[model samples]
Target: MVLSMPSPYKHPSTGVYWLKQRVPARLLAVAKGKSVTVTVDGMPCTVKLGDYIKVSLRTKTIAEAKQRANEAEAEFNRIWLSFENGPVKLTLKQITALAGEMYHAISAALEDDPGEAALWAQRRRERAEVGAKLKVSPAAALMIRPPSLEARLGSWVDGALKQHHLTVTPETYQRLLVEFDRAVGDVATLLERRSRGDYSPDAVAQRFPPVEIEQRVAAPKAAKAVGGDDPTTLTGLLAHKQRTQSKKDDTFDKYRGCLKNFIAFVGHEEVGRITKDDVRRWRDALIKRGLAKKTINDQYLTSLKVALNHGVKEFDLPTNVAANIRDERDAPAPTGSKGYSAEQAKTILQATFRGSSKNLEIPYQRALFWVPWICAYTGLRVTEVTQFRGRHLREENGIPYLLITPDDGSTKGKNAWTTGIHAHLIELGLLDMFRAIGDGPAFYTPYPEGTDLKSLSNHRAKSAGDKIADWVTDELGIAAPGDRPSHAWRHAFTTLSRTYKMDKEARDYMLGSRSQTDAREGYGDWSPEVVDAEINKLPRFDVEASDWRPSLELVPPRPLKSDLPPRRPLRVRKLRAKSA
Candidate 1:
């Protein structure tokens, strides 16, 4: 016997035919239901009725079902066409008459078939039972779509705050939003799993619990003046301080580490409850860990004090318990020396050319070659040099310069400044390196977008600096009484600037250091040309490292109009003279 092809209206799961049709966009909202399912000889079949009607002839025999289904479909189309052409609109009286007719027709149908009414009531009970199991009330189930987790949490928080008549600071408000979003996300994940039958309600509650809001009792005016049960912990205070303050990445990391250590030691206690003894004990513990007294004072003590002081001011606490605690006065200075000498700088640069101690990867080798040279010429901090991008390099009035700004990342004082690129660096192919790196960061390998952690970038750059330092110390056997190999270049730059009699304002501007005088010397409209002139005054290094040059040959891209700011004339101030 030959096999027959299946009909297009059949549903594979039920082995029964269905009549499917699309609902018109205009009638979808008012349509009673999309489709209805019926059983044909114990097999479920679907009849789809949109604004227009469609019917399926449900039968086991294929030949009989196809013939009957075509006849039913033709009859439905005829009735739908007649209804469509009959009337587009009706008067208010006519609408009332139609509503009466519908009500009477429904009542007659229920009165005529007691079994149909009973079956309908039974389904209603079953649906109510299922809704109860899902924790959805009958009224809630009537909603078109349930409110999202974020919306629900936001409304709850707003209601809680209003009920308590509480006002929170911007920092506190932001923290609450972050916490609520996290909680909502957790609850939402569990709800999704529960809906998909992957989790039971009890399992969901056990794994991801609901958020609880703490109750606040109404307090007297005097009690309110002193922060009453504010629930702000030491950790919260420290986080708020870091968010509000402008600090470099390295400095911020140190603060975070110090605060974390204090929290671990002292426990996450209330900020107002921490006493001076607690701070002193923490300091003593650091000292017992073999940390130098100076380290305890400078790193641990300073960070703790700042956090407590911030808490005192922000939370209106009675006192800063860590304020009166003093650092060890007789603590010895650090063992190793700081800053490099001229001779040491020469030896380091030469060793970089020779690849003296050990080999490095290409990216690291490139950083090793240029970072020291840039520091040697400009006295920039290692981070400052490493964070450079192609856009930071520009030409103003025919002179090339590096715009040491926080546009890309943090700066020393969180202030923007510009300095000229030394001529020797240009001769050593600095421009070529910028061209090779293109539009993003200039040094080290480019991280994939968001993965560029500031602390990690600084650490890697510092590691590269250390590698150069190690090469100078081990291979060249160069040592100074109080010198750091990479930082020695900065000292060397300062020395050369002073030796050549470069202007104090220009030198300070290049170094990004503050001037001694009360008057803001370089803040007013100083032209890049003047800064470039002072930077050019520094004498070039006369080294014999012939193979130390960068081999990059790409042409530098032209600077955009936004990169090169318009030049303004320097503001000159008149001096007052006194006569005796």
Candidate 2:
């Protein structure tokens, strides 16, 4: 029981004290379809509720109220017609106010700061104007390949912007500029694709420079030699190893650093003159300088082996100098393993499936998360998965699978082993993704001709896997496991298969690795259907495929400048009020 406050003025008709109306009399009476005796300053004002009630009913007589309502509605119609006719004049101040309001709505839609909307709009407007004047879109400046340039490259740029929270660095800007030119050069090719009714930007970008793994550094002397040396000379044993391993130039740089450090420690002795003892000393020095034993060993052995092998292959040295140097067996093996646990992996997958809001932020992060997840669950190597073509996917006996064949001139190593489709791949929703990418070899990395995107994808995948592993470790408040890579997913699959007590032969077949045999082929007894069945038998990840849908405007707004009315000075009071 609450006490009621006394009113200063009493209702004219009602003998009881009444408070002021809580809502607009016409709104409450007319909109709600209820008739109520509303108190206007404690006066009993009877108003009809519902749409039929006029706002002027309280002040005007019945006849006058009806007439006024008709006039007001007519005035509204005139204003609307003027707007449609482009004669609804607005001042600069009015346009700015409307723009501010529009920015707020757009910012809300994008879930970003409203303040940034003005900046984005201004930049977009400027870009449009520039493009119109130049008769080219910013994309036209990019030198992307045909279909690939349009499809994969454009999407990659958008995803990079969103996921990495990245901006173009001077180096990146230069690269983009180079790609822009390459893409532009492909205009003729793009036009052909368009003629065939396939002018998609992603397709153009992807098609622009096809992958060529045979690119070689200049080395005239040792053309038949496996490897070469000469730190300053790009070719040598280091070059051979890079080509054999299908590794990127950066990998060569790592070799250069590690090799230079070792050679400097061992002095400038000729290749055959450097003994196994010197190799051990350099290895120890690398270990002393805080290098991982694995890294130190890899670098030391590769460089030394290159020099020794180069001597044997090119300079006719009797024996490899560092052939007898044994690796330290007890160097305290690497302990900091890195990878997501089952639960952590599941959590990350869930976050990705929920989808990210629009921003130049989380959407890209989701892509990074998604790519690795797809790799892990599918048992595909990072390179194989990233360089996958759409044509690789096929269905047989009512089951979908990925048939991995090396693209034309794109085979790795000497043997062109055609791997059967893994039925488990369908569970990852890659089938649909492949379908969306259209016909052709779908690439993980869209590289120019003569550029090995495989190497770049490998390096990027490794780094991205590390970052995700670090994030997982941090989130779980646990130390990282061994610096496991996306390849570890393949390892994990094999390990899991073994743990589940699968047959040794079956496990080998399922993993697509060769079993020990004189035939040097995959287990002969395994049929394609059997291999497919075994792959399908594996546990499926409870993850949804990412929705890479196009964002279409529900209601396209008229261009602000084009929609503007004739310039007019608004009333002084209205302008001042607007400022306030």
Candidate 3:
């Protein structure tokens, strides 16, 4: 007769249960709040109540938790089993292929596979040797996790207990790997491709965390103060020095670019160790790289100069390294002078008239041409040209004259002076220039408040001036002058004025020169009538004279020599007669 368990219970797998074992005496004898054990007659086994209940509830024999644990156990067991399974009994080709697959799996796990796949190939050879030495099939010699003895004895059990049905085909093995990977955790689609072995180690490494190189090339010894704690980096030092030196930002930027390229070439480590030879070699390379010799040389020189200067001021490196390093004829020389000759000035004026034939608002090209030309002809610097105003044009006793009142901050003194405008400028139809701009003193360009009487020392004005010069040279085939630029016009004016035998006082006044005499308030006392007479003599391009007049009165004529003014008592008198 079969002993049986009578119970109300739940199955772990199905959540339903049926009685299948005996309820031993010990289970019946179980006391309240205490576990008991019972023996089943005929079975000769004592079953504890807790064990019986557990057995009864888990009717299907495996709990869900147990199933998961079993799966994990089976997985680790499988990996170990692979080691034991004495290499699959197969042809050399088959074993060789499987060995390669296993190595790939190992590498994927380790993430350090070499490029040649040599590790996998080696495993295949080792396994083959083991099989030969054993003389039995390599499959038997190879260790393996064995099937259950009871399951092996019963073919039915053998088939039923199999946990996996994976066939080791190359594709199937790869799929098993991908599934195993995914089973652990879902991978990104990109990473999934790598899981499929469709990617290279580089491709995979790129997908995952990359090998970051923490080490970089050392930088040049920086120009920090000799005993400073800041680790010297060339770039940091240069930038610091740039701010410290009050160098123009653009100039600093240029120096920075050259330095960066040079440092990059020599590498950070060798930056401070650089020799003159290294620089020469680098310079040669720049030439070979198609850089103009002058451009390369200029860059090199600027960078070197900045670096040496920084060293002197900050790092206290050996005296200036750039002092003697000079570029030869291969390098372009500095710009000499920039101004238009008389012929070139005329061409520029003509171009201005042409370009401004239609528009009036901008008139930039026209202004560019005419403004500088006026300066050139009048011997005014570009700054003074910008400072000219409507009030400056006045008539003295029927002759057109220009009153040059220097601004409080003008390079010339704040004192005012009067100069005759050449009749030729009036004749040349330039009177309209004065008329177009109001008597209110201001630059042709709209500037912010307080810029009245301001000049062209600014970058924008200089750039515009350069472009105008280039246009005159290129478009009109003008022969431009060297050196002085708008300033040179003053020189020309002084030269021409002297050639024309214009009075020294009149020439100085016309050129806006500072007065030489302390006696005449420095604006030497020239009579308006005489100045007027001098101006009337000048030639012009036929501009009609306007009824403008000077507000200031003329200097009184010197007293006649015989009817001279009374003199004050002299400080030094003949020694008084000692007697009385």
| Candidate number of the best TM-score | 1
- lDDT over C-alpha atoms for residue 211 of model 3: 15
| Ranking according to lDDT, highest score first | 1, 3, 2
Query: Tens digit of lDDT per residue, candidate 2, span 401-487?
Result: 555444522223312333344443454455665676555433322223344433342332233344444444434333324534455
Q: How would you encode candidate 1's per-residue C-alpha lDDT over 64-175 as one tens digit per residue? A: 6765543343233222322223212223332233223333333344433334334444544554464455366553332221244225344544432332223333333333
- Candidate 2 has its poorest 10 consecutive residues by lDDT at 571-580
Local accuracy of candidate 3 as per-residue lDDT tens digits, 212-324: 11112234354454333232455666666765665445566677667766654443422356567546645654654566666766786668666766666776566565556
- TM-score (all chains, Cα) for each model: 0.50, 0.45, 0.35
TM-score of 1: 0.50
Candidate 2 residues lying further than 4 Å off, grouped into runs, are: 1-258, 264-277, 331-340, 354-370, 408-428, 440-480, 509-512, 516-527, 542-580
User: What's the TM for model 3?
Assistant: 0.35
Ranking 1 against 3 by lDDT, winner: 1
How high is the lDDT of residue 245 in model 2?
58
Model 3 residue 420 CA deviation (Å) reads: 8.5
